[model samples]
Target: MDEWFRSWGLLRDERQRTVFRRTDHTHLAAVCWPSCDADTLYDLARLAAVLMARDHEIDTAPPEQSISMARAFRSEVSARYGLGGGTGADPRWTPVFSELWHSLSTRRSPRFMDRCLATAPTEFLTGCLVYRRRSGNATEADELTAYFSTRRVTVAQRIDHLLAEASLGIELDDEVLGDPLMSRLLDLDVDRTILIQDILSAPRELAAGESENIVAVLSAALGCTTPRALEEATVLYENLTDTYEQALTALLGSPSGRDHDVRAFASALNDFSTGLIEWTSHSVRYTQAETSNWTKPDEIVARGR
Candidate 1:
């Protein structure tokens, strides 16, 4: 872990390192990766470390610079094996990806490995960059949610699809990939783990000039007032929560869910969502302002710029 951290001055900023140590993702990881074998956990940690660093790079950088990096990223990653640095990529992080590429060469199917290890992260980091760029300007809730799906595909693919096999680790062929129930479980995990943050932090986020909040995006999209958006976002959050519970129940009842390995995998994924909910509810990160009623997500008020 220390070696990977040193691969590219990752967490080099003392302030960032401090924040990384206590990052909410770490809490989420604690829930998901606890039972993974050493190697699997190691692989996940390395990938996440780089992704998180890259995500934070944009977060901490000036807006123009982040936009520049986002625009330059496609060209930069296209030449991952090139010897020289391109426009936006850090040369040092190249080696990090290079190392992972080599390690993943045998562990996963070549194409799946390529997309998950290479294409998915690029897509996800690109989405994050675009997110920062459009944070305050987004008017389409569907588009915002699409970007949110990138995170789900990236993280869940690592754990469920890649490591857990077709049905969260039951090892069915590619056929199971089309399972709608599985897709629902995956999406529920995503909104549960990611989107809820937007609703809970709407106040602080709006004050900071970021409109990434679900409420803000819905407000703009629905052409409604801020309070109405908040109410709707709360309703949406509740829907997401309810859907998560139902999907998880169905996951546990499916044939794949009958497998011991799949059960554990699904359970870990569920724990991650629940853990994040508990953490977000109490962590100073979102509690900077008084929060809405936990039992009633609809009660949360929205803040505006």
Candidate 2:
């Protein structure tokens, strides 16, 4: 392993001995590359850990300190890439490494930060750390739990606020959580939800008149659907919206409303919901138990395209 990996405690040998649990989808990495060697995967894992730690640090840091630290990190990364005055390192790293670093380092841009935090490394790391606490080294796990608990809750609240603003929020109360079908909805990544919303909102901006094509590309990019949703993709999204809203209303013990566009955001996330379920079932970002009970529908038809 390289010094960076060792310094971050992501060494492959060490990981093998420990219960290195992880459950967040590195969507960018999956979309960009088909596969990688063990070393590359370990590097990505380590980088993920570091990025997640930095996320908590930035979120809890005072505004001035956060901004300053973000700029400094950005500058440091840019310098390594020869953007600022400094000698650049060898360009031997995999493309995923570079992409992940760019996403993690773009703290100055809220849009970029939103995208990163949407499927942030911290989310996955938090899941893993919690899993470890329940299954593996307690003392080590407690340290991680203590360090990240407050930060995780803070970030989650921020995300909840964003979801509310977007009208995509649902009360994750005992009633909702107790329902097996409803609770899985919480797994929906806020970043992906926003991306889907943006694409569905202004499809032409992304693909001119080929909104369906763009949706297919997005579905493929997200690893949500295979054989592409194609001509039926638009109809699928619409069906998803209506059905999702209905499901949400039922779960929330509320009635559906006429202003469907802004209420509960259930419809806006039909594609995302479907894709997340499909993707998470097989993705390494979730545990087998989490997906074991998932029942795939025999058919996924939408209204006539």
Give the top-scoring candidate (lDDT).
1
Q: Per-residue error at 229 for model 2, in Å?
A: 34
Model 2, 180-245: lDDT tens digits are: 444434433333343343333333333432221334344544555523433344554556456555
Error of 1 at 183 (Å): 2.4
- Indicate the residue-level lDDT of 74 in model 2: 44
* Deviation in Å, model 2, residue 305 alpha carbon: 12
Model 2 misplaced stretches (Cα beyond 4 Å): 1-95, 100-109, 112-120, 137-247, 250-265, 276-299, 303-305
> Model 2, 301: alpha-carbon shift in Å?
3.4
lDDT of 1 by residue, 1-305 (tens): 64556546756667666555444444334433545555656666666566666655766677677777655554556665332343325565666776765665546665665555456456655665555555435434445556455445433333433444421323434444456776777667666655667766677677776655677667777788878988987887788878877887897788766767656666666544454455556554566633322322222111100
Q: Among all windows of ten consecutive residues in candidate 2, which has the lowest summed lDDT?
A: 27-36
Give the Å error, residue 293, model 1: 21
How many residue pairs clash in all the candidates, one count each? 1, 2
